[model samples]
Target: MAEAMPQTLLHEALQKHRAGDLVGAAPLYQQVLKLSPRHPDALHLLGFLLHQAGQSAEGLKLVNAAVATAPLHTDFRGNQARILLHLGREAEADKAFRAALIATPANPDALRDLAITRRDSGQVVAAAKLHARLLCLTPADPATLLAHSGNLIDLGRHDAASALLRKCLLLAPALIEAANSFAFLQITIRDLDLARDWFRRTLAAQPLYAAPHSGLAEVCFFENDLEACLRHSERALELTPDDPQIHVRHGFRLLAAGHVREGWQEFEWRLKRADRIRREGLPPRWQGEPLAGKRILVCAEEGVGDELLYASMIPDLIAAGASVVIECAPRLLSVFRRSFPGCAVHAYKREGDRFRPVHRYDWLPKDPPVDYAIDAGSLPSILRPDVASYAHQRPYLTADAERVAQMRDRLAALPPGPKLGFCWRSKEVAPFRNLYYTGLSDWRSLLTDPAIQVVSMQYGRGWREEIAAAQKAFGARLHVLEGVDMTDDFEDILALGVAVDAIVCPSTTLVWVGAGLGRPVMEFGVEPHFELMGTGKHPGFPTVRVFTRSLAQSWEAVTGAITDAVRTL
Candidate 1:
């Protein structure tokens, strides 16, 4: 009778709880617990209500009591597990969930909650299988389908995600989340037009969906429509101002489009992605004073060309009156040292100087003590180094005199007419950047005509098949140079610039280097990229002639352009 009294009170309290009146539910549950000290239902319900109200310690104690009283009750155990999961007590939650499932083999809610917990804990595949099982039990549940689709996409099974999304849409045509997911999948497959159409549909169905706006912005960015990119990104920022990735993407697009001042300012948000940029002891010093007489350390972060581009800022830093210490790549020590005689250059890999913690400078200056912090690329605008400035540094890059002499002798032995250098692919992985890689068959046309002598100046490993094919097809016309240690990118540019009559390649730093040195360069690539060949007649290199693919033509057309350029040369 005493135990039944608590159960009767618990049934009444549960009604109040479900009616959204926790205030009325609480006292009734406590009275029931008072009537029967070990009543699990009253104890668990009161505990969950307390926890939801943020009295976690009191709630946990009550929940533990409930679980202890009703050890075999699946509903009580599953509720306890959900509370643990919500509190992020993952190990205990996993145990409780498994025990609940053991207690009741067909608890769909338990299975779904367990899947959510596992996914949150990074057991992705396990979570995915559980979600799949949950779906079989609860078919036509849009929420279940969406969860499965998310896992599939995370596992890179875009096709599977797309199929699931289609099913979800068919079931519920207004399902915006599934539509957005399907739209993103289209973008992943490089079907931009189709992706754009889906994005439009998604936005039409649900205008408040902020996620597809990012997708639209990405499409604009890839199409090189800076104006539309800016508009969409700004809209995204207005909707989600605190999202760090949004700031990073907008900043990257701005920088890539050459809007330095505004771009660099927004780019500072990258530091917010983590508590610190690198684990190194250096901290951002934002003392906000004149740069003169201040000792500043500029650390290296990105690629070699990036370092070179920004190293051009050393003179500007010195001019602003700071004693600059550049922490750079060891391979670039000599180059930077030569470039900035007024500043101190240190190798990033070096560990000898352990003690100076003066002031730190990164590309982004949150609290700059000195006057400025400019990334390598941004310094160009501040310094405004004209073509003549770079031109005077004509042989700005120098190779080992011995290596150059040795390479000259090695090439002299080859039966040469007009020397042409080759770099058929870019090391950059982005499809937009990598899509401009020159096709090998393009080179075949130029080499098949015996008038041109080609040398394999390409870098990177995995080009063995292309090398073998080029050798097999072009025979004596193609000379793959050996022993010409193509170590650093700078050396690769200098060697090809001096050694070749015309450097034929994709859009890369080499294009800038060759054209900067007045070496005739024919850049073979697709059309939209032709405009990216730089601002002026050739803002980066005067000697560079761009050959863009016409509508619907393969690289064969680009190859024809290269062959014509070789003939002229």
Candidate 2:
């Protein structure tokens, strides 16, 4: 076998590898390696083939040896970095990437590898900068554009990311990846109708791209069309059965729609997203008959509002004789700790000695170890909250006394009485979607009346632009809350709410908080959200005044109704 090798053997093997004929070139490459065990080219090429063949460890060893022997070889270093990345060896992969970059500064492949490694290592800003540099060298490169768009999204620059994707689509409308990004942004901005349009367009362009099917399934879920969600999710699973997110999505939709028994069983796929349940730090528990007297760790998922909404279920689980440990976000740590004073609570990501369990409830164990485990959403039904019983207790959140005093003093400086807090715009920024869900212009009508002082409780970008225009139109009526920096934190949000007479927001989580506070909340929007108002009255909060788009998504009519209501008040 060693004697059969010619100079062209390496070349022939390379050609076969390029043509995806790994089996055809295996014997020839073996012969070459047998004759010269130290050959860098043979080692590098075989390493790639071995990795492709699912022998990652051996492949990595061979690739590392090749790189050591040929330290300056760009191809060897790139291959080594990629194999490290495939195995999720972030630190080692970062070293290989830097080596490759030093060897080939202008190499687009190396730059891409470096960007991916940065992203994997949680250096997203650095990765975005590298991709931006790569895009300059290769402007039309789809991969570079995709990386940049994803980075932009992580930074919460959804509008910029969507713009880049739209440009990418215009350049190559058949680019399924770009279409997926476009569709995802639409969902984030609450443009489900437009998202459906994008998904249809992408599916038309590439019928085999199974990713968009998942998007379609989510859209169906949002619409409360469980039948369609199931159908689309099944279609997606047919195309990509191993996607855990798809399984979780399907399971959650099923659970939310009242098929709880099976939904919990199906929803266990969430553990597969990462190697372990890193957030909750609890072992996976299977679904079966609820075990009595078992120690359970009920893991919290999703946002802060979600944790609060679901914490009511703790008493029920306790009554079932299961001890509970609540794991949630750090900001919610103080709040949840206070709310669930009877039970133990901890921040989700902090690692420590594992909580010993009679039976763990985090994972979807096949035998269903513990007696009962449920998501936060299940708490509401388990403990049907009667508003009347909790009505007199008012103020679920406390305003920072100092911040409240500061705000009060500021408000006192302005023309006094009947202050209306306005949060017209939502954080979302897709022009059409934002306009549909947030009645920014609608609230502006009330701003011009001069009778009521408009306090700007609206946070996020683009508020300055709107305020600047409003100053030109309705000069003295607008009392913009100047120099008071607020965050997404509930403490800051509550402070603003406490300082106002009544809060007017466009169908946000703020509306929920206001209603919970027994404040007069004017909920305005151009279209319905979560079946809240088919015509009038919000299903979630009865106290909220519903002013929706009157005819064909008219913001004017909604705003007009709000002004008329305020005038009557």
TM-score winner among the candidates? Answer: 2
Mind sharing the TM-score for model 2?
Answer: 0.72
In model 1, the runs with Cα more than 4 Å from the true position are 1-51, 54-173, 184-192, 211-233, 242-260, 263-280, 285-289, 302-308, 325-410, 417-419, 428-434, 447-449, 457-461, 469-559, 566-569
User: What does the lDDT read for residue 516 in candidate 2?
Assistant: 50
- How do the residues 493-555 of candidate 1 rate in per-residue lDDT, one tens digit apiece? 465567678788776656655654467888876544422322424443457787876323568
TM-score of 1: 0.66
Model 2 poorest ten-residue lDDT run: 352-361
lDDT of 2 by residue, 1-569 (tens): 55446447888988898899989877777777877888888888989899998988899998888988999999899989888878988788888988888988888888988998787656778889899889888988766787799889877788888878877887777789899879978877667889999898889988877789989987776665767887887898888888887777766665545554445445667656532334432454424236366756666655455555445456556666666667676766765565556667766543322211122324433343433455555443333333222223333434467766877777788784577787776665554445446534445667777778778777667777877876776563567666665445556566677777778777566675576555688877643243241224544455678776622345777777777776665
Candidates in order, TM-scores: namely: 0.66, 0.72
